[model samples]
Target: MKITEQEVHSVAEIARLELTQEEGQKITHALQVILEQTEALKRLEISKVKPTVYVLPLQNVFSEDQLDKCLTQEQALGNAPEVEKGCFKVPRII
Candidate 1:
């Protein structure tokens, strides 16, 4: 697709940007070059290639889940300096 200076101006207006004539022309040319470069990529053969979220194989690295013995609430708060209504009490922040 060919990019035009008018298109650049339109985009600039939408972005609330004030581009000089030179900057607009430069941006238009740059966009045109980018589009032209992408044209070569359009010729790649991918008929047999399946679309994927990842380009490489991915696997879970996490360990297996298992139930184990845990401390009770009374044991957990056994060493607390302050405990109020079965909860730890911290200094109030201003």
Candidate 2:
């Protein structure tokens, strides 16, 4: 899992990245540590633990629907830039 500067440079060449020599060495070491950590995770024992879908309990706390007063046709269409035959006239797409 240990990545070297030559491997990082090869990957950078494939990805079209122009990393400096110092940056390439830094990236190689960082990538090596990440792979080592992932490898270490494989050694953990969790066979007796049950898998969980949600981390926290979820519940609906919304209020019930209620009726309300509505606006008239003239009030709703008052802000239209163009109207024809009691309806808004929009530009045709096709």
Candidate 3:
């Protein structure tokens, strides 16, 4: 689980990153710790445990969509900055 400076440098090169000597050393140590922790976790026995996407039960909190009254075209365009042909006029985007 030990991470080497060479490995850190290789990853940095692949990611197009320019790491300083100190940064590379720090990253190497951090990666070593993470890998060690992951190795420790892999030792756990979870054969009897059921797989779950979430720890807690979840339910939809939103109300069902329903048809509702809509504003008239004139009412909808009343506050528009600019209107043309009974619709909002937007700047051309080509």
Q: After superposition, how far is residue 41 of candidate 2 from its true place, in Å?
A: 2.0
Give candidate 3's root-mean-square deviation (CA, Å).
9.1
Off by over 4 Å in 3: 47-94
Give the worst 10-residue stretch by lDDT in candidate 2: 55-64
Per-residue CA lDDT of candidate 1, range 1-94, in tens? 8888998999999999999999999889989999999999779998888888887787776866888889898998999999999899899969
Better of 2 and 3 by TM-score: 3
Candidate 2 lDDT by residue in tens digits, 1-94: 6678999999999999999999998999899889998998678897887787877777676876987878887887899999888898899969
Better of 1 and 2 by lDDT: 1
Question: What TM-scores do the predictions have?
Answer: 0.50, 0.45, 0.48
- How does each model score on lDDT? 0.91, 0.88, 0.91
Clashing pairs in 3: none
- Give stretches of model 1 more than 4 Å off: 49-94
TM-score-sorted candidate list, best first: 1, 3, 2
